[model samples]
Target: MAGPQRNNHKRPFGNSQKRTFGNSQKRSFGNSRHDQTNKKPKHGRQQMREIKRMGRRHQNEEAKEDFPDFPENDEGYESGDNIGEEPSGAMSLENNPRQAYDALMVLLDNGKDEKKTTKKSEKNTAKVQVIDGNIPGNEDEETEYGIEDIDEDEESVKKEDEEDQNDLSEDEEDEEDDEASSDPFEYHFANPQESILENFEQQVSKDSTLKWQSTKTSTSDKQYMAIGQSAPIEEQLSKGKQNIRLDGNLEQFKIKSRMNIPFDDANITNSQKLILDSVFKYKDVVFPYQHYKDESSIRDLYAAHAVNHIYKTRDRILKNNLKLSTYKEALEQGKASVEDEPELRDQSFNRPKVLILLPTRQACFAVGEKIIEISGLQTVENKKRFYAQYYSDDKVPEYKSNDFKYLFDGNSNDFFCLGMKFTRKTLKFYSAFNQSDIILASPLGLKAILEKKEKNKNNKDFLSSIEVFVVDQANSLQYQNWGNVSYILKHLNTIPENYSEDLDFSRIRMWAINNQFKYLRQNLVFGKFSTPEMNNLIGNKHSLNLSGKVKFKRNFTSDESGIGQIVFKLRQVFNRFECELPVNDPNARFNYFKTNIVPFLKEQSDDKEGGGALVYLPDYSDYLRVKNYLRYETSVNFCSLDEYSSQSKLTKYRDGFAKGKYKVMLYTERLHHYNRFEIKGVRNVVFYKCPSDETYYSEILLRFLGDSMMRDVIKDINLSVVKIMYSKWDANLLEKIVGTQRVPVLCFGSNEIYEFK
Candidate 1:
């Protein structure tokens, strides 16, 4: 550095010297550039102050344009004078790039205007001012400008966006209010406090005298009183003896054909009258009457109730429609106000309010006939087609049992669903379920519809509005498939997935809209006998009817038990097992039967004095397990018959077992229930589990043991033996078989075995 001092001379670009790019002019690059050689460039607060100064200058220029008399060289206009002064309403340049951008645009436009207007001599002056005003030296001002501007722009933009969103939301709310005010039916009302159940009770009480008469005079008696002795006296005086008698009989028949007569006019027994009163009062009833004999009267009572329900429902709907129409007309005529309009709620999800569940097509036909007769319809649409589909002309097979004969008398097809629509003077059969007033279906048929997958959902929507649910001959359903009945009940009175196109939301009852349809539904379950399954269904949570429920009690004495019908004098042994829980009873019973009963059965089969042993299992799963064990695990020669067995296979199994080719015959209760085949050559019977229907036990014994012809053929009456396996869970079955008096002794007794002859 000392050697270099020999060439010491004043440089043209000294710190004190000035330089210009365009012409001879002095220019300054602010304090940042001036102190760049000795000190670090200014940043943060100092730079921000400079930017704010530029913004103030822009504002001053705008003020000058507004007021031409304003001073240009004022203290506010001097950048240095206001360097330490806080900007008036100044936003930080780093936080608000919009202000900085405005400052920049103002500087550029001023420079262009000066260059265009001034002489070339003044061009350098304007250029120097523009460069000195904004340009920074020895620092990355471009990078700083970009970073600060981007951050400030993002924050400012977010604030603006939030403000816009708030404005839009307010506008949307205003529009919604406007729309609501314009439409009268758009507003939804809260659920009403008053229950419709009380209304039903009141109506029933008021109409008791007209609807429920207790008089003994029948419709025939009334007609006879009207005719007096005139008809009979005229018939006796007439010369055409046969024609006159026929005319008299025809008049009597006509009187009987009028089924729309009052309840007292029918030839209903006192017991039936008692049942009908409860039914008419909308009380749930479980009547275990002899269905074959009382079915006619029961059908008439329910049919009348169903028809009356339909009429009342339709009348309410029509009344509401009329009121709404009148209100609309008055409003158009300027005679009424919206406040004066009445509130009416009378509709459900769909039109079908009555469901009659039957066991077979024949039963459905009978219900349809009763409905028509009760409705007093002079015209029936599709009547012939319904008859052709449900009724059969084929000669019925000669069944040995009258119960079977009555059960399977007509078209016994179990899969059927029919819809009936009522008009002013006609009843329309085979209508769409959604358009029908009444639905008649078998459990199996309805279950199929419910389980079916459709492109459009809500296949069970038609069942959503069922108000009166009737299950006639429900005992027969247990033999078919009790699960189907449970499935149908599970889906009843549910909210629909899709509303009907014609549905009036304004007319929907508050209870229905609140999903309380099940509470208002009336259930009528009629059967020959009660089971735990039926009791469980009746006590289900969904069966909570607000009106009330009634279960007809059946008292059984030891003398009335089905066991008395058995003609065989052989000893019947009942073996009991212990289980802590009902769920474990099935497994425990199976194990005990395999360990103790199977060995005894094997020993009995080995004897040459008898044909073979028959083991009966009620549950299909138990049947399958025993079947697999006998076929694979055991060395027993056995033939089996279940619900799924083919006719040919069943015949082969029966013949082989009868001919002593098989040592044991495995029979399922369901098989006997569906086809009560006369199983012969069963010398020894072992009940793996008791049948649900107690009559089945007697039928099984009587068919094989009590048959004198079979006993004579086999000559093994004295060798015959019956063994039944039971547990506490079999109390229902035991009650029906051995009478109610013995149920407790057999179920809870200390002894594990009992014998009867």
Candidate 2:
């Protein structure tokens, strides 16, 4: 007993070994807390919660694919575990500098050597560097002027809490206390991380030096890191509400004859090289996905090298200015702004010089990264330039240039251009027009921004300087919203006259008169399905009336990537269309639904991979009819959007079918309006009705096709495409189903599986 009391397992140097930081199991540094008095960041707790939630959702997705035995109910989803998750991009993100540095700090002890090893300053990421209880940027604060900017009204919750403490009745206070204590999880909707990050976003918004710091209190046995230092801790969130920045020495953008950023040029396909050259030439060229001959991503190739061409143009302009070139020459070249008038010298400096629109938020940022990498912008002395900001649903971090940037220790005179993902919030964010350059927005995002600026009378001559306009997915863009396409076409490259006092034209790179820009932009639209209507959008693309200049419906067909003549063998379901079901006499759709769709789905109901029915109907009414038919007419496990409207519900249904939860997944094409889906690994692809637009022909097939997603997400399979062709309109889809030699094709019709002979 005495020996046990004096055990040799004593704490090292008399320090208790039991003490630990964060979870003993995970052995992370610790859950850190920042200066709450300055701004209560969502750092410690709320972030952990969101992280846990996101992890679970990812797990569920993988489990649904792997285990194939998880329950198919929405119970796990609705329990507040998985909802409102927008994937940032289709590709894996390159490692962020700040993220890598912070991760390194987490593994090291709080020894002074830790700081020395990571002493190099980073431009993009802010690190917490609290010393002697003094926080940077907090010493001058008297009141919370701009700590956080919530989407909610700008009222301060702290002031409200003060008022409550000062004037609330005793009974009211007591009742509030009881209610608060009743639910430990309940708190006001204020996102702690967002509020804390609000000022940081705003300060960093205008490209200020944001130094996020952390204080490490460490002894030999234990180390405690301040929450401020561990902030990525979280990602910038989803790409929708995200921001991006670009800061590099102008001198660094020189030519690297042999340097290629994402991939070497030799691996680049000839079609891709042609598109790249066309982009540089300001030619309106459409390179649809149909022309893809190699496995290489043409999108990456275009964005990477296109950025090089843009930089070349800008470098030429900068050198011209240095060489004392006449303002007229720079204006004629149309590469940058060069205001000669003294009055125009003081104008806003953050308008976009170029514009590119992609299909999603992630694409905007990913392309931006490629541009940055190829430009040799890996390191920079200053971090206060919000060079690139992607605007999405506020998920992507927006590059904000401080309107008060001059007041901060950042560049005030140098003009800045940000790259932002286009989100619905782009309509409301007032600073977008002033700060954006090389805008990367979807057509819908541009529409929202256009409408908001128009309604608010803040048309700041921002688009007048645009030199290039590129739409990456012209065909899919047309399918998503033809009206948005029209809206962009009507105003893009056109100089508007609604002047705003807030706009500082002098800061514009080539600030002449607002209406005096000499360049008519070159437009490049990529359309998978070539059509004359799309060509019209580029009408007079080189014209000054905001109409498109030269347009070419370039469908570069190569035998290697072509869907070969095998697709020509698609057979008509009937020897001819006979009135088998009289329902078509009154409702042609109903007869096809009963005669063609019903039987094919019934046959697939017994497949080992869960013979799930995937019906893509754009209209909600038709979705209901199919869903009802399956429910009442057959014993198939099926569900629909009858009452459920949330994406979580739809996800559950789709995932359930994939994991053997249901036999049918009735998805509406309308879901694309909210957010598109690329469902993978499903066994049967039944086309209830083919789309009128050939643009969507390949898209719809890819969505349900056995293997079109990421290379590793699902295994390749021989697909069985079930076609419902009761009428000629419906029968026309047979050609789309029996595609060319890119892959083998099989179609089920007339109670027979027809192989492309």
Give the winner by TM-score.
1
lDDT of 1: 0.57
- Tens digits of per-residue lDDT, candidate 2, 1-757, equal 0001111111111001111111111112221322222553223222222111123233344434422433243332232112234321111000111111222222122222224433233211122211011333332221101111111111222233234333333322221211231121111110113343443334444653334333222222221111112112133323211111011111222333422456544555444544443343333444444432321356565565355444433333233333343455666788546554222121222245566665443344345556545545433211111121222222211221121111111111101122331111111111234334356556544544454312334443456556556666554454344555566666654555565444544344332343322222455666444444455544433222111123322222222222232232222222123453544522666565677677766666665553455665644456666677788888766655321233455456556665666766676553432234455445444544544334344454454453422433233333445343334333323333333221122222343333332
What C-alpha lDDT do the candidate models reach, one value each? 0.57, 0.36
Clashes of each: 0, 68
